[model samples]
Target: MFVPGTASRPPAGMMIPYTEQLIFTIATQIPFVIFFGMGIRNLISRGDPKALLFGIGGCLASAYEPIVDVMGFCYFPREGNWVAFEAFGRPIPIFVPATYGWYVGGMGYWFWTVLQNPKTTQQEFQLLWLRAFIINLVLEYPPIYLGIYIYYGYQPLEIGGFPLWFPAVHAASPMVAATVINLIAPHLKGVKNLVIIPASVMAYGMANAGFGAPVWLALSVDRGYHVSYPAAAITALMIYTGVWIMSLQLLPTQPLKINGMNGNGKSKGLRG
Candidate 1:
């Protein structure tokens, strides 16, 4: 029932002090940053260039969330809910981008992990989508419950105060990142930092713009909330489903080779 581009004050009773908000922001973002850092290091040390590239791609892709949020295409309503610093014309927490990086990187790593499992069968590919959904719920529900942020201004169907389409959206993102990275990995065998890094940013942007533009437009223009939930949900589902199917097609059938040493710094097989 919220309107895009319109600012709203937090409900009086729900407002938390800036200090508390900062604490929450730091608490949530640090773990993701650490985890992503560790994963990136492991990938790099092992010379698993493919996994490293995709992980970075996911990080870059997720960074777009904050940009869109600040432009008023979406609303976070974090002004009173947290200590805010202005960027791109909106008061947002500093950790917003980091949290997104964590999410996308974490999810990308997850998808990579699943694809690399030696015993995984083609039938198990379907499980990637399921894992994406579960991960989405796990990551989002806590923030919603804590009132860290909430969608406003003409959201679609929701579950427990979060948009129902979110899990699908979240699920689609890593797939898009993975598909882009996988398709381009061969050409990017060397100088990946120079080429793949920028390419990943552009690919992520294009994927989000292509898939998310309709949803954004639908939400933006229909300030009256006239867009039916079913219509919106269907649109989201179509986009996500297409991405999921494309990912299944692009994913390598063979188990991936892990590059780094095991716990004792000893090399392991592809199953590692």
Candidate 2:
């Protein structure tokens, strides 16, 4: 249970009662179950399974958590009431992977659908990342504070007791994953659609490594320094890079219009 490179904080007073931690677990778990059901509904009723497969892949993507955690200086308490898996010394909670499935996979799939609309513009795509940033910041703050997971070292844009830089960079990951999946979507049909599952893991792995590398560079340097400014520049560049990558995907084809009308004023609807 003892992790070698684990964060040094978590003062003795930091460990709350397991009973209280269970509340956090169930709270996150309920929504994850709901998301799982939604994925199934999409598959059965809507005749689409990308979301479900990606959700499963997101769960598998959880396997990469410990590596990222250890390298990126993220920490999860080992004393948790539920431990799904442990690697490189860190013990991640069961809710962690559950959230990954819904938040990472579900949201990524949603982005994929949004991008499917040839009408969705580069500017709108950037706005989506902004929305993602706000959603992640708010959603992460509470659990990051109460759930007892944290980024331990030199964070660039630390805010509300949580590092803003991490979320900022993380927001674009779904976009990156979505963009990559859309490339192969046309060829995906029948059993081939199952490719989405591995694609989810592959996309997630590349996205995290690529988008997260900047802050990782700064964090790896500072360790316990906990300063900003210079680190902030790296953070901005990283976010901009994510936006640029997303915007580039929209370049080959131009978007139609704000209203669903293209050229001749014909009504057009978005497809996932």
Candidate 3:
């Protein structure tokens, strides 16, 4: 339900220097370079190829970026930037997908690494979410500061031109993918790792669109619906947060290390 004239378009005549745009685009790939490098090293030495597969998958997953931006009321600039692809009257920048691949793919790889630890605790998982949230805030801030994009509309909990709601969902998507991949990666021995390429993309969509359905629906219905955008935002935030926390609690528990007891201290599992 894309309502015409509802998107918050960047102001006309707004343009970033092409040099600056190029610089930003290259800078965003630093993490991808590092992560992809690590993935290669891991593949050669440890035979673990999840990271590499995820990086490639993340690059492909950028297709979802334009779709979500339309629903989320975001408008990426096309005036003086490298346009990756256009959709629904919006021209997304190349840097947008670059960040998605590096940020989501890289972070998802890292998060899955942590979840791989047999000694991981529930607290550690929550910490991963917090860290991703903060990193997302930092990554997104630079583009907005450079006038490369804008989040327009009754965006809930916006600060410094970026909305808080964006980071919450942005950060959670990688975790969702990482968690799902962790459950199945081990059984995929040898060439089996390649299968996760498409699966990771599926997880990416589920994490963003599925978990974010509440807010997406809210934004779509905000035009004439009696419900206020902020109220709908608040409700959606609670639901997203609630489901993530529940996932943490309900997932299988690790062999916790309490008071220096190491993995021997099994304690009461995650569900309890």
Candidate 4:
């Protein structure tokens, strides 16, 4: 469905063929689904550090959204009043375009959370942002060149030229959001694995699907931008943020070793 904003069609050349896009979609989501399921299992088994990581990563993913929502640049097509939106009165609607940036950002956030464990203190939280930026750079450039994805706002000094700053914008903003979450994680209270896993997973899955778009359109009319696209991107960010913090909270609580006694059945670790 079209939202209440300007009905700018996605860049013509940027649109992948439906069949190919579908294949890519399935390919992309399958691994995430598997990993998230594994994360759920780990969370159920009392504690899994990676599961916690996913949870926290999912949560922090939404950090950049409020600004994007406010900017009127976001919109969608609507049959009714074109100016009215549903996303809680925002100007645009939730759609695929809105979502693409943050989905990738969540992955970047996840990498940083795992690489820099606060327990070790080897790297400060700031370094995590740096690492996330670098890794995203390494990952996104090749894909763009290979036509795996195309960026919309990447205009260079010349018209249609490669924008030097585009990748940096994509990588740095989310990393900054993640860094904020990392800084605040310790101060937040009542963190637990149980809270982390399910919430993070649900948020990511739903949001990535542009969960808010239909609802937003249904509610008001003119809400956000690209009804389905932006919805997916924001969802990814929200999920990442949730999962990232969840990981932080659960990491320290995991047991180093649950030792059972030898054949003697004497106290070995936990049994002892």
Candidate 5:
């Protein structure tokens, strides 16, 4: 029994117009689609079934958003003309999940790329985390600013009206993805469709535990459905960072020399 409250509602004049939303939605999705396609194609061509499976797993993980939307944990305002559907009482744009898939899949490919290079050190991992934070700031902040989606129930510590920990959550996602990819790499290389089971579990677990739990708990308190910003923010940071650390711990002690053929194939040696 969570209510998103008024903060979740878009301010007057802030809601994206139907036409603009449609245009933006399509435009944004195009690049991600292209990247995902290229990544998949490259994996296929390079005979890297393990990487391909990881990418597919990432896409599947992104589908968890629909459940979040339906549960009233988050809101994506509708542009009247966009294709719409309902699940668990939530209205969603068709393209929203597609974009999410691209994002997650793209990250999975990135993780695969990182693993393929020579041995990675803690310093390199830190740099990669910084890069993810910056990238999320660039990509995610705008949508929040534009009212593409509103955080209704919980008001975690925010900058520019969005949770401050969001970028960190974004940053951590690839690490979790990397963990999943590396864990299944060996088995997936030899088994066809075997990735489907573990990938499904990881996707669902990560989405629910990593993303959904913190928000849910923040709203569950006596304050009703409003976000306990501090608690929520802390929970997000902890979960995300913890997962990221776990991923790092789980990484291979020695990096595998992946040839340059797949999407993440560019050889960038670990910087000194």
Candidate 6:
């Protein structure tokens, strides 16, 4: 996506040293840096333990993203020549750094804060999630629709032996990761975790389809695959509606801690 206008074709992917890659990768993934930075700021301003946890979550998510990319484990095209991990006899994906940063700096940390404070009955958290989801859609939609990444000659992951949705379904990786983190974080309930799974899936699926990334490339870039806009459209709608419904059902139950005993001098799980 960062190719300069004058450069019609990409250079042969090469592996720079980790130190060099670190500098460039950080520079390129600005959105991710900002996201993590915001998490830190929230931690200091609000002094919410959850905010700090979210910052840590961002770092962890950022770390894993590159591994997924490097191993070609999840999906999407890589940008540079393969870098191999010495212990593992395989090459790493080129887009690992940027994609990982995108996850942590953008959504991972934010999702952590929300999950830890799910008891928030106020509209702020709800509205924030909605806004974040929308921004993600807006930023991601066009690359797939226009086949912009494909035109750059990167080979994305294939589904059913065909190129999956443009920009690739793996774009939902962070959403999936954050949801998993939420399930394990303190104060979460078994039931809420179960409910969040499908809801998140729906949200990501709808977002991918609705904004852009039609079932097939509209311009016949991959003519082998048949276009079925109806199927994609319907799936997206179902996912969006499903996520919305579940979110409503999972009402917040915040302020989970109790400070002391009840009138009977017995332990009570009630907020002071």
The lDDT per prediction is 0.58, 0.74, 0.74, 0.40, 0.57, 0.41
For each candidate in turn, the TM-score is: 0.70, 0.82, 0.82, 0.40, 0.72, 0.41
Error of 5 at 259 (Å): 41
Clashes of each: 3, 0, 0, 70, 4, 7
Pairs with steric clashes in candidate 6? 13-81, 14-81, 32-105, 70-92, 70-93, 119-253, 119-254
What digit string (tens of lDDT, one per residue) describes model 6 on residues 89-182?
A: 2334344444444453345446545645747443443354455545545554443343223223222334333333333333343344455555
Across 139-164, the per-residue lDDT of candidate 2 in tens digits comes to 77877777567666566567766877
> 57-156, model 4: which lDDT tens digit per residue?
5544343233333231222223222231244443322223223323433453464465455453333433454555465465445434444344332122
Q: Show where candidate 1 strays beyond 4 Å.
A: 1-16, 49-59, 70-74, 77-88, 116-123, 223-226, 247-272
Model 5 C-alpha lDDT versus the unseen true structure: 0.57
Please state the error at residue 200 of candidate 5 in Å. 6.7
State the lDDT at 141 in candidate 5.
Answer: 67
RMSD of each: 10.2, 7.4, 6.4, 13.8, 9.4, 11.7
**Steric clash pairs (candidate 5):** 8-152, 153-227, 154-227, 155-227
- Candidate 5 lowest-lDDT run of ten: 1-10
Distance from true location, Cα of 204 in model 3, Å: 1.7
What's the lDDT for residue 95 in model 1? 58
Error of 4 at 86 (Å): 9.9
